[model samples]
Target: MNESRVVGQVRIVGAGLLGASIGLRLRAAGVDVIVDDSSPSNLNLAIDYGAGRAARDTDDPALIVVAVPPDVTAAVVATELTAYPDALVTDVASVKVAPLAELRAAGADTLRYIGSHPLAGRERGGAISARADLFIGRPWVVTPHDDIPTAQISIIEDLVLDLGAVPVIMSAEQHDSSVALVSHVPQVVSTLLAKQLLRSTEAAISLAGQGLRDTTRIASSDPELWVQILGANSADVVPILRDFRDDLDGLLTALAAPAVPGARRAVAEVLADGNAGVARIPGKHGQDRRFSQIVVMVDDRAGELARLLTEIGGIGVNMEDLRLEHSPGAQVGLAEISVLPEVEDRLIADLEAGGWKIAGAWR
Candidate 1:
């Protein structure tokens, strides 16, 4: 069966979102999984959620996944390596170099361990927020050092594949620097921008739209946890933040006298640069091709979204992406569907013919 394709048993430590998600997916594949957490309640909650069973004394695992906070990841990995001498161990910490360095310093069996980071997560934490498909179609980086054997690396890749995530092999340093630019710095920027709302009047907030919501969606993440993550990866993050600061300073100067010579051009240059940078971000299925977006208005009621999806499937158009936005007090929600540019006109015509209100289409 499918269960025999992966490791026979997986022991998950730290029953947070990542750990519990791994457990849930593994259990679905019919693999034996046991979960543990520093918090008894968290462990019980994860088990209750059907992530996995409680750890038992006689349980032997072929693989162990450490899913703790960045600060304590090294200690836990070292401890796990010592305790389960026969098991392969990996961690899902955002920062990789620090933990690897710490583990090496502690004389842990580095050969039996590899560090990994799944470039996927919601703004929320905890097992209650976990989902079995959390890593599906997401990039999961497998950080391997020179000491690790090529054959042994497959152990982690097999798990990543089983969880439906794409495995990317790289050194720990490269992973740390890459995530600093993409993940860590973005978190800092979002949190700081969201903090500005504290002084905004209710009237000012009322005018907010999808742009504000999209940019600051991750600001809802826990502060204490982010502090641990940012601090752990500050070495790579600080340089990026400094560059951002320089850009902000230049923009502030240009805004100080917008009518001055070259001021408007400077602002335009900044915006154009942003357009070029964002376009570099890969689209659906890791392709760089941009899709045409069609905004369809739907009434805010049950079965409306499902009906739309069902109709789209019947139309035989492959949707590349979908996003929903609701006006603050409006009874209608906007469904932004992204499709291939070539099919945009036909799909829009068919959708309108089917009595769907077409808000707009960007071809």
Candidate 2:
């Protein structure tokens, strides 16, 4: 229970999705991970799910990740560091700049601390939805200060590596700004869009398609959690929202214009530019590469996907990703599996040979 000792243990100080996932991956890698949580039920559930053993007592952990809520991040990290002085403590808080500043204000050592945010999560929360591969092929951003030890930073990078995620280095300010652009702003927009439909007619809402669903999916996220995150990072997000509002005003003005030749073309050109901007987004794993999708027909019955996955396994094709979309009127659902362009033909042939139905493959 003393500092400057018990230096080989990996401790995860939250039993939520991110913390449990980290513990699960580290435990799978033969690393001894000890878990702690304010909620004893969540802590026990995480242990039951084989994430890690419950911490018998807090001591000098070798590496500690304080994966708590954004508002509590600084206070929790500061407390953990004080109690375990020799530990290299870090936090996976979504917003970094505020927490780092708060820790500094609390006189916590910056040498053994780093701020990290793994750009991955489920629509669901809690340890029940945790998975060991949650961070696999995801982007984990690390913000290391000038005073942070090189060895400590490397250890954090190594942890990201072991979790099968790509570690991207950024400063606290840069990380906050970039996340505001990509993650934080999108959540706010999605929530706003979903709120727009809250009072819509039942018929109009029922007629909604995949575009609406996809755009507003994140709006289903925990609103309370989002409030805390957005509140903490409001400095970075407000400017982005102002720019979005300007763009939206431009679109509204363009639509209000007449259907004259130049007027229509100008609006179309702006829409085309938006399309190009979207295409620039990395399809998966931030590889900056396009993916080819193959749509396969799957029945709605249980074990149907398991059977199809078995056939896919026999094909020896590596699938980059998968998305399931049920056809409204059809008896079958479309399973769009994304794979490397070169493997599409082989995947089709193998599935056909295995007596599995093929829908269509798109490049």
Best by lDDT: 1
Work out the TM-score per prediction: 0.98, 0.90
What lDDT does candidate 1 reach at residue 192?
91
- The CA lDDT of each predicted structure is 0.92, 0.86
Error of 1 at 259 (Å): 0.8
Candidate 1 lDDT at 183 equals 91
In angstroms, how far off is 146's CA in candidate 2? Answer: 1.9
Evaluated at residue 347, the lDDT of candidate 1 is 92
Off by over 4 Å in 2: 1-7, 327-330, 345-361
lDDT of 1 by residue, 1-363 (tens): 155357667999999999999989999999899999989999999999989999889988989999999999999999999989999999999999999999989888999999999999998889999999999889999999967888779989999999988999989999999999999898889989999999999999998888899999989988888899889888999999999999999999999999999999999999999999988998875788888999999999999999999999999999899999987888999999999999999998899999999999885
Best by TM-score: 1
Clashing pairs in 1: none
